[model samples]
Target: MSRHLRLALVQAPAESFEQFADGLRLRMKSPNRAELVVYPELHLCSRGAEAMTLEEYYDTYAEPLDGPRGAALGALARELGVWLIPGTVLERAEDGKVHNTAVVYGPDGELVAHYRKIFTWRPYEPLCVGREFVVFDLPGTARIGLSVCYDAWYPEVTRHLAWMGAELVVNLVQTSTSGRAQEIPVNTANAIVNQIWVASVNGASPTAQGRSLLVDPEGHVQVAAVGTEDTTLLAVVDLDRVAAARKHGTGGDSWPWDHFAPDDTPLELPLYGGRIDPVTWRPAVSPWTPEALRPAVPAPVPTAPCPAAGAAGEETAR
Candidate 1:
């Protein structure tokens, strides 16, 4: 079987949830429909809230996963009979903190998976950081990973997702700044390094700089949405390509994932002050496991003073 999934990336313009929902209903009325549809970050949030304080706006919409808005989104997906990723919504956690979280709804209106933004564009973004990496199965088609706007900028996030066996990493973005120019390259870079498919979807004009792109496992941009215009990019991605890329080597050259042998010397990482045993390494631990939930960054380890050195070390210490 061709494990190809047809997708529609909705690069809609600045609009409220109601407007987007209505448009989605109309779009699904057509015969040509994508099996899965994705929107940009914060697509359903009230753009009118832009006038309000960020805190006010986030608090106003923040709700749990089973909130009315979430149920409505799930119903929309079921009614349309398509897998839907309606960008992200502000999730009100049990601890009363608000998080920018991405959600997926299946064709059955079932909530598939939710991943809170890990790297929340810190120093500017007030949302709390999420600790775990999330990947979900698309049943027979593929296993997918979720990340928000700023998460793609960190290679560790995507690398971990790939380690968790994600064939496609969906990076939903909403950048209204010039920094988007750099995101494009990083999107491709992530795909190249991981040998996985990447769909970096950004919003359209007035709200974002829409230079969304879909990259193949070999880092080739298959469909790049031009300009900051409201548009829909349709493509059929074969999950098999990801397997083929990893198996045959990326562009038939490097095979990073399988390069190390069991008997090979463990490569030492000075920053971590240890080497990962190639035979015993397990990078993708289940996020839900209590023992697996280590601090996002490990605590600093105390080390003994360096051995007495020559003039160079003396100068460094001074």
Candidate 2:
């Protein structure tokens, strides 16, 4: 398979859906000549105290997997002749909750994948969170593993995606003013460990600390924005490069636990009856163990503070 590809990262300050769409449409006017265009997370909503309530935000900005925003994005991808990876948005779900969703469109304006941020940001606790990891196949290119902000902090998730055969990973982040710095390394490490390319974008200026970065399989920043200014960054990635790294003696050359070890070894645990059921979100126990050994109760969902900032007022500006 061919590895050569180009990517564009949109780093702009946004206050509303129209503003975000305007920036993206302008960027589409003269695309970066890349195979993919990535935008920052939550680029559709205003940031800060004025950020809209979950309901208000969804009512105004949320799109179905095939809504206008989705169609427009798909059109941009087809018009530019490149894959489009817009940052995450608040997608209205039937459960009356908003999902931190990311949508990917193929070059032909086809829906490739739609993923919700599994590890939702703590501050945005009131917002609904996704419960599963999702990956989708690219028609002519390699499969893509998708995740949203905060998911990068946990490598196990990325590792799982990699194990599932995702050659490329897209992380859509809307990092607050204070969290960008710490998030970079976590994301970088994730790319390195998975031996896959990671394209990440963030909000810039008054909206966010836009430091969109495109990382190579070696965990090096191939392209990035140096300042907190609103701008776009571009890079060319050769998929062959990532494949070669994996073929070589790289960190995540393959699954970490390739061969089964002795039962006492850490990697052997899974082989020796320590595996989690992939279908059911539960641990798989040994057949010899009696049912009495099971835990009496399921783990509790931890409660956190949600400022309830938006539900009570009009979307506040930062």
lDDT of each: 0.83, 0.68
Mark the regions of model 1 whose C-alpha exceeds 4 Å error after superposition: 272-275, 280-318
Candidate 1, residue 30: how far the Cα is off, in Å: 3.1
Error of 1 at 131 (Å): 0.6
Best by TM-score: 1
By lDDT, the best candidate is 1
lDDT of 2 by residue, 1-318 (tens): 344566678887765655655666677667554567777777765554366665665577665666677777777668767677777766777766677788888879887878878787787556677877787765445567887778888876787777666667888877766788888888888887767788778878877787788888778889888877988887777765555554453553453222222322233245447653322332222222223432233433444555686853654552
For residues 1-318, could you state the per-residue lDDT of candidate 1 as single tens digits? 447889888887756678888988877776537888999988877587668798788767889989899999999999989999999988999998888899999999999999999999878778888999999977777788998989998888998898897888999998989999999999999999988899999999988999999999899999998799988888899877776665577878877776555555689988868776666433342232233222132333445556766866889989
Clashing pairs counted in every model: 0, 5
Q: Per-residue error at 25 for model 2, in Å? A: 4.5
RMSD of 2: 16.2
Report the lDDT of model 1 for residue 195: 84
Residue clash pairs of candidate 2: 3-239, 3-240, 50-316, 50-317, 203-210
Candidate 2: where is the Cα deviation over 4 Å? Answer: 15-22, 29-31, 47-51, 251-318
